[model samples]
Target: MSAIRHALTTKRADDFSAWYQEVISAADMAEESGVRGCMVIKPWGYGIWERIQRLMDDRIKAAGVQNCYFPIFIPLKNFEREASHVDGFAKEMAVVTHHRLIADGKGGLIPDPEAKLEEPLVVRPTSETIIGDAMARWIQSWRDLPLLTNQWANVVRWEMRTRMFLRTSEFLWQEGHTAHATREDALEETHRALEMYRACAEDDLALPVIAGEKPENERFPGAVETWSIEAMMQDGKALQAGTSHYLGTNFAHAAGIQYQDKEGGQQFCHTTSWGVSTRLIGGVIMTHGDDDGLRVPPRIAPHQVVIIPMLRETPEDEALLDYCEDLRKLVAAQAALGEPVRVLLDKKPGKAAAKRWDWVRKGAPLIVEVGPRDMAEGNVAVLRRDRLWNQDNGKPAFSFVSREDFSAQAPALLEAIQQALYDEARERRDANVTRGVTSMDQVAAHFADNHARPGWVEVQWSKPTSAALEAATEQLKALKLTIRNVPRDAEPADGTCIFTGAPATERILVARAY
Candidate 1:
């Protein structure tokens, strides 16, 4: 037990990255896999993911998006239909060159030389091609214009480097594909999906995010426009939490998706796609986590409250255990009475304090410890994770409330914690964001110094040509800065291009992204 306890880091301030790995591993959330760029999420971690899926799934269904499935393989011809899309994902595709393999008879395997496919199949990096092909076959009239469908599946992208929940080679996600009769309808769907992403991120996950359109260069391939929700992590870096794209009939035109209108005129169907992935787990970990461990919001925590039994080898211990059993029954009853809370009683022995620490590290919002002292007094010791410095010294800070009266207070306390986490994250986001007039040189300086202020800097480009934009992008890359977006409402500034001193237009957000 000491070895296990020592294996985990104690100070989040000393080494955040190390602490993160410790917390994730100690909580039995995930484990490194033999496969490069892959991880095995333990039951505890999968429970959290399931909770997220439940909430988001309900919301998506309520928004009139029907769930569906599509084939994971796309023929090479289908992939090349949209040149831009192919170009964007060509480097990362995992191609299936053969359909069969046979034994070599020497304790080895060999690809069957005669089992060549007519055309290579590419494991989908995204489902746009296959979904578009199906849409083309199903739609023949304007009445079938607005097709909304969603799929929960795994996608593979051969990444250079991978983090467990952040950027694995294979990850689970929900992607929405919609078709509309006109560009206006497609654009509306894009914005609506963005709003839903924000709502789920902010309200359900308790993470504050900024929503805006991506710059032309950063937009999705084959998309007229792309928008995203950018979340600021605790380490002062930005995470692209989710994205929604407005295709403007690009895919439809490429895949021959056409519909006849009321006037007997045939037109291509406008299209949109949006998705949020497991990367959200990483966002939540970084957003609300502290030095102790993860501090998950009650709204999404798999278990909102944990009860730790402080046992001993005595009659008093037996009495306390009995009391704990009673208390568990009481809490369970309250939960069954429409309390919207899930509680667990941990009865492991050895070190009660250490067990409490473990639960706190797991981000359980409320912890209750039953001991002989409390049993003698006919009460229980309650610990609140959200309250800062509950005691004067600020060491192991918490109030010891009576078990009998806890049900009345626990619900409100959990709600307050949920709200406070959001408020705190919002404040940090506002404080870190910096805005001002500047040149490309100044933008470089700000990012290099680790000053997030200039959350987004306002600069004018003398000439907004592709070459000029490329030069600006190169400069930013050198300085470790990337353009987040080019505001749609940007007006001509009274200055030259920040990089080339050419005539410039509106302000844009330039930051280092994850």
Candidate 2:
């Protein structure tokens, strides 16, 4: 096992991309599948996803959104109804040509020549088309407006590059589709959904994110306006954590969804769609993980605390086990009271310290070790992953706490850990953003020298014309990045443009994003 482990190589400091793959695989979270761009999320990884689902599902329910199911295969014509929507997804769709297969003489199955679909079905990259069709049939009057529904399902989008949870061909997510009588209501829904995503990312996932609108180039294909929550990873690259799109009446018009107003006037319904996918798992890993491995937030960690029995062949092994078991029961009882504590006793035969390290690599927030020494003294050794050991102070990585009183104190410790992680991520984000640039030279210099910040430069793109902005966008693209947002409060500046020094009005966030 040691030999096999030694063969594995990961670039901890120099190659963050490789390090991510190594840590993910080493922790047994997921594995690459036989199918390109797909992954097999292992039990441990799926456990995290399940926790995310439980939390987000509750939020969706509270927001007056009803859960519903839509078919995985959408008719080709339904997709084309919304031109921009189709254009965005056209390149990524996987179409089904034949419906049946038969065994050939050589024993391999072959597509039956007689079984061609009348209208080739496209595996849904997203469900907006089919959902809009449903709304068209179900909505006829103003009373039926604001039809809010959410679907938790898998979507397939073929991609050239893939990561375990970040970018995959198929992944699980919840997409919300709503139709409102007026544009204002639809806009409200979009912001509300974006706010929910922000809360989930910060409060639940413990990752701080900036909530704002996407630049024109990065907006969702069919959306009139798109908003997103962006979080910076440990490596300084931005992650588009979640998105909410105000689709206007585009889909309603395309799908023929019209509602009668109070005055008996027919009008197209305004629509909104928003989603957060398993890519959040990637966000959590990048935001909190260290060189050791993944550091999941205590709230979302599958195993929040682990108890290890520091037993040896000395006559006290049995006593240590008993003490550890008792501690586990105490913690479990506290968890039953809604404190969200999860504990595991490591009874495997081996070096107890090594077992503790194993749990640390798995990102358990807390570890408790019981031995004859500690058991005899009515205490257990406690160690926290969040608290770094101070060599200057001569502090050991582990400390001692009374086993009887641990349950009462554990909750506070976990809360401290949660706060510390959030603060650290916030600090990183603050340090990364750059601000107050008035020239194109400043933008170019910042991008070349510091990717982390000046975090975002507030610049006036003097020429707000589409052609000039597009030209600047092309230049930024060469740097492998783009603008993130246009500030709502941007004012026209008399100064020269940042890129061309022409006359400029708005400030935009520019960054290389995932």
TM-score of each: 0.90, 0.92
Query: Lowest summed-lDDT stretch of 10 residues in model 1?
Result: 1-10
The residue-by-residue lDDT of candidate 2 on 1-514, one tens digit each, is 1112221256456688888887788667899889998999987688888888988998999999999999999999998888888889999999999989998989899999899888999999999999999999999999997899999999999887888899999999999999999899999999999999999999888888878777666779889999988888887788889999999999989998899999999999999999999999999888887766777778877877788887787777887887788888888776521455777788888988788766766677888888787888999888887763445554436878799788667777777887888999999888887767776666678878844343555566654557876888888888777777664345546566677766665567777777
lDDT: worst 10-residue window of model 2: 1-10
- lDDT score at residue 54, model 2, on the 0-100 scale: 83
- The true-versus-predicted C-alpha distance at residue 49 of model 1, in Å, is 1.6
Q: Which residue segments of model 1 deviate by more than 4 Å? A: 1-15, 313-322, 332-339, 348-350, 388-394, 450-465, 486-505
lDDT of 1 by residue, 313-371 (tens): 66677777778888777766664212467888787776888888777777788888777
- The alpha-carbon lDDT assigned to residue 191 of candidate 1 equals 92
Superpose all Cα atoms of candidate 2 onto the true structure and report the RMSD in Å to 1 decimal.
3.6
Candidate 1 lDDT score at position 209: 82
